[model samples]
Target: MRKMIHSKVVFSPEDLIVVAGISLQMAYKIIKELNHELEEINKKEKKNYIIFRAKIWRKFFRERYYDEKFLTINDLEKKFKIKEWEAKEIRSTIKKELVAKGFKFIKGRIPEKAVLEKIYDYSEEERKNENVSKIVKF
Candidate 1:
């Protein structure tokens, strides 16, 4: 995958054909349906639109579908390249603090914000802090 999921990640019409292997007509129809649904979802934004915001068209299908937002200590250790004990400690610390911040989770699962904030630093503009992040599978 050339693209990684982000706050504003979306695909283009050409992406549908090349990546998804759908017909051009089907792509257009799908785009129409997606736009209609998105408009309904963001009704306020649809009403008074921001011209520079490129609201013309895009395929934002991840948030609605792919949801693997939590990870275990083992998962964190492997993904973040940290020691198992460190991962355990970090998860322990984050879990305690997150309870006050309205974050709920299972016994060994922690939110991916553990990946987002603690591991990979995200800026105010939704971009990564330094170079490329490990989220991209090379």
Candidate 2:
């Protein structure tokens, strides 16, 4: 199993309640629920999860734009017949959620997960190289 070092955080009950906007008991319950569901997550599911989330946004944009022609925000609003503010809110909400989930999203653009994977690969390679040089010198 791969291990990750994460900084420990200590939070008071009230502080956590305020941050999550839930009572301590409820927060604990939610965390318990999440923990149970998270047990199923692994590398295979993680890859599919990111892809699934991106595909959802892709579908949202496609459906929001009603016309078969070039679709703009105006077309989106007109097709959905929703207000401009509503359309804007939907887009913002989707982007915000993706970011919170560690998925980078650009307006009118979707970044490939390979970009983040490459960054991780490069950092790991650098660490390996450093370890090798240290061993050689010693």
C-alpha root-mean-square deviation, candidate 2: 16.8
TM-score top scorer: 1
Scored against the true structure, residue 81 in model 2 reaches a CA lDDT of: 80
Query: TM-score per candidate, in order?
Result: 0.39, 0.26
Could you give candidate 2's per-residue lDDT for residues 95-115 as a string of tens digits? Answer: 565567654332342222222
For model 1, name the residue pairs that clash.
none
Give the C-alpha lDDT of model 2. 0.40
- What is each predicted model's overall lDDT from 0 to 1? 0.54, 0.40
What's each prediction's clash count?
A: 0, 0
lDDT of 1 by residue, 34-128 (tens): 56656676785556422212222332433331223557777788887889999888888777776766544445666665546655656334555
